[model samples]
Target: MTDTERTPAAATGRKQPFDLGTGPGRVLVWFYGVFTVAAASRSIVQMILDFGKAPLAYVLSAVAALVYGFITYSLVRGGERARRTALVCCAAELAGVLIVGTWTLADPSAFADATVWSDFGRDYLFIPVILPVTGMIWLRRARTA
Candidate 1:
């Protein structure tokens, strides 16, 4: 039998492009999912109730939520296209974290409130900074040869 014929997915006709839902990929998916929800909820509430206080921070949080949601969806999709999309998103997320983190540090007055990426996610234990790096590495390794 061919390689595809030997796998369970092939038997089931699923034809998984790569097994991103297994092992560490699962963990990455979970984290991204949580981040998506957390950021969305936080942004929505802040925008609704206190937008005038920190519009920039709240908007950035909403943007972060969107990115996290897309990355999570891509990871769970389990295809080459999805994987590549997730990889790009993860890189963007990392860059956002670094840029926002540095801005928050360099100019505290610029933001009246904190964002998901502020301080490199110090409020979230720096997960925002670390997760993208982990995701990129996992995605690169998860690619088919």
Candidate 2:
């Protein structure tokens, strides 16, 4: 029998592809894309409005935005190099969240305004805290292919 005919599972939906691009991956990609825009805009507005007030925080905001952008791009590109870049960015994101979260919590006065990493992304319902971990998991899964 042909490959398709040899598999009785074909009678069911088991023959279908995982639909990575259209399903979970699609949601993940969209989330990264939205964060890219949101974080970029936030950094630009903060820097333009009063970067002198907190140069370090503003610069870190920009870095976060860039990382989010890179993650979004890598997810859409879907390849070996892209996977590696995504993995690196995700790890960096995790570090950023942890460091910034601790710093902000320990010294709230240091942060005059909210940042993406502030309060562990409390403003965004902690997605900012959890996204990198999820991204890392997804990146690992993609690597097996």
Query: What lDDT does the true structure give each of the candidates?
Result: 0.94, 0.84
lDDT of 2 by residue, 18-48 (tens): 2234456788899999999988998999999
* Regions more than 4 Å wrong, model 1: 1-16
Show pairs that collide, candidate 2: none
What's the CA error at residue 135 for candidate 1, in Å? 0.2
RMSD of each: 3.7, 4.8
**Lowest lDDT block of 10, candidate 2:** 13-22
TM-score of 2: 0.82
* Candidate number achieving the greatest lDDT relative to the actual structure: 1
Clashes of each: 0, 0
- How much lDDT does candidate 1 score? 0.94
Instruction: State how far residue 62 of model 2 sits from its true place (Å).
Output: 1.0
